[model samples]
Target: MKWKKLLAATLALGISAVVMAGCGSDKAASNGEKALVIGDTTFNSSNEEPDVNPHNAYAGWACIRYGIGETLIKYSDKMELQPWLATKWENVDEFTWKFTLRDDVTFSSGRKMDAAAVKQCLEHLIANNKRAAQDLKIAAIEANGQELIIKTTEPRPALLNYLGDPYGCIIDVDAGFEQGIVAGTGPYIATDIKTDDHLVLKKNEHYWGGTPKLDKITIRTITDGNTLSSALQSGEVQAAYGMAYESYPLFKNDKYNISQISTSRCFFGKMNFDPDSVCADPAVRQAIAMGIDKENFVAKLLDGNGFPANGVFPAGPAFGGDKVKAEKFDLDGAKKVLEAAGWVDTDGDGIREKNGKKLVIKWLTYPSRQELPLLAESAQATLKEIGMQVEINNTADNNQVVKDTKAWDVYAMANVQAPTGDPEYWFTVFATSNATKNQGKYRSARLDALENQLSREFDPAKRAQLALDMQQVVLDDHAFVFCSFLKMSMISKANVKNYTSHACDYYQVTADLDVE
Candidate 1:
């Protein structure tokens, strides 16, 4: 009843909020102590954030996002590379990179951070983390004093950008994981961690950057959007990470602060290209791409909190956004394309049939990301209008279902297309023929060759154009239907300070974060 009441009454109205369920109050900041609680939707195992251990399968997202870890390199507000743990880096050769580590840095383990510490951490990462090892492609590492040298297996043009990734968070491997936690050079040190529940953190007094603003911080895993909304509204939490777009109106006022920015988090569909699947048909793939109303979906269902995507990347960089052309939402055009390909509703049941088989799209998606299920349901309705039957299989066991390619026609998922602010990440992870996560198994010789060129390319302008060419190859094949780009947002109370949003969407809690 209280949560329902608070949902109707926005925090912008200045409701007398308390100290986050009184969980952090030790006489209510009597000695000028500061505490904060953040409700994050993407902290559970379902989002690949089982713990703060950076080496364990995307847990690095939690490691970096929660201020428990710091990377050697970080991205600026413009997605440009910035010095973090490492001060200055030099591209020594085509296959070698030299990094100058910060001499003043010390891990929470009380160990001095040097080239040896960083070298040990990176070596441990290469051995334990497969994804990081693959992205970094490190052949050998040499350390001398405060300088760290990394020799890649090949010429990695985007090596610096990859280093800015979450997995690049430097941790003290020698400290060991007592409870899936490690010593890091972040503003905060993770003290207590309970999976799917809460993570308690304390300020790192010897933090390298600056004295942390908050003395204590609690990050609560609130997966439900409504509960997260109510928690922040009732002051059960001071801030929220994954607020529903429909709930945006409730916090748009003086009492609340909404930090939002356009990110490369694209929600797209990968058409099943299995020979046995109906989506294997080119007309079906094209129709599927052209039928879904992305513009209306962004404007209405998304509450205008996203951009209608034209390609894998959003509109800004030379490689992504509107650099290339793709199919638009045209129902008539979709129907004509299907009809031309000999798929027609002969039975007049508003369901198309091709040679005795009905054009049924078995859409497989998960609900971990709030907007994904919404996209599936919305596409289901719109696809029906064009004589296509959509059987929705929205489930949490999507990873299991996807293993059987016969089960799905179009597998839709939300992904950060460019987490490292580079075009190669999306293609290498999802589009390349050798990509392990290539959901649709779509392949093109031209695309693979272009990727090879992009990998070795050192010039900035050439790399940008190469990325654009690769996007066109996928679009021409109708392999993936690019839907919309997410506008990442973080909702905080007016009293919270500097808990800002980043374009990279990796850095959240930082030394600047404070509570009034």
Candidate 2:
């Protein structure tokens, strides 16, 4: 009743579009104050973006997303790498790369950005961040005035792409990370940071780039979609990210602009391979793959925002999409697969049983990504029809809970499978045998060997083929189920300028972002 009433009250914008100037009212307040607040769904600690310290966990995402940090390289709309802090770079040898630094950049803490600063930042990152240390085998680094050279422990063909990761945001290590805030060379400087609450930021007056327009910016973590929508409607926030698809209809007026783009962000499930777990059975994994209605889930549940994904990487890059194959939705085929695995509905209670146990999938997921919970519920209903019982454990403590292999049979989560516009990011973090966050404990010897070849191969064509081969290995094993890619949208008031969405989804707030 509350949701329906809220929807009813918010839907009046359709009628207001005729009477008023547009769906939202014209600016009646003074333009002197340029304080802007944005409602974000995944801004909390639960999403691993707890603070603006780039070296701490995944907090670098928050640092980059909110314009508190800048990387040496950034991705363009075409997903190609462009130099940011670095003027130019070149591969010196099989294990060495050198970069020319910009001469005029300074950190928010008033320190000059030189090759020494860059060297200090990366050394601290490789020492603290496990994923960074593994991905970037930086055996040694040499610093000269504006010339910084890096020598990897091995031949890393994709080193530049890995450096563009959110964790690659360069900061002034000497300034220190006090109160989770580092001296960054970005447009904004974080003032206060509270986990699972809100972040306060102010424009960097001495920013090396263009002058920041807004005086103050607040990023409020609104976990609930309804509350985020209501806040935007009530003028509490000038913009909102992660608004529910159902509420998108309320904001599709002349007054609100929805900046949307297709992203490689995917909602996929990793099957646990515990020895005694049912997901250990290859047939059970195959049946579970074919059981979910991915097409309908995207059409109805997702409101046709995105397309059903066939593999880990979407169909944009040479190694993405149809290059690999996954299971299709076929109820009859799924039933046969389950029966062949000795799981049957012996008691005729609709759900299948094996020996004395029921065919129940402990579906573990988190609620921070709105699409994830929706996918879990959607899968629960669809899997039920295919003689499987899904017990969902959707909580914010998912990072801790997923650590226990026995607690979850299938863990559904949202990740940018190709955040760096490279297929290697996905395999190194999840699919590889020694993956940093391989919560499912899935190991494929062939996949590991292929990833080894991919890491050292410098040729783009050969890398693409190796990636294609690696994806097929995991898909054939039914280790991960790729559901649908995300079509992200950022709904903001019409007055907001340059608050556009990026294909990379790494950048949001910038010096150009202003409310006029």
| RMSD list, candidates in order | 6.8, 7.8
Clash pairs, model 1 backbone? 314-321
TM-score, one value per model? 0.92, 0.94
**Model 2 vs. true fold: TM:** 0.94
Clashes of each: 1, 0
Candidate 2 Cα errors over 4 Å, as ranges: 1-32
lDDT of 2 by residue, 1-516 (tens): 322332244334322222221123223223343667788999877788878888999999999999989998899977899999988999999999999989999888788899998999999999999999999999999999999999999999999999999999989887777667777899987766668877777688889997898876778888999988888988777898888887999999998999999888898999999987789889889998998899998999889988898988888665568878899999899999998889999999999999888999999999878878889999998889889999999999999998999899999998888888788988999989899989889999999999999999999989988988988999999999999998988999989888888888988999998887
lDDT score at residue 358, model 2, on the 0-100 scale = 92
Candidate 2 residue 448 Cα shift, in angstroms, is 0.4
lDDT score of model 2? Answer: 0.86
For residue 446, give model 2's deviation from the true position in Å.
0.0
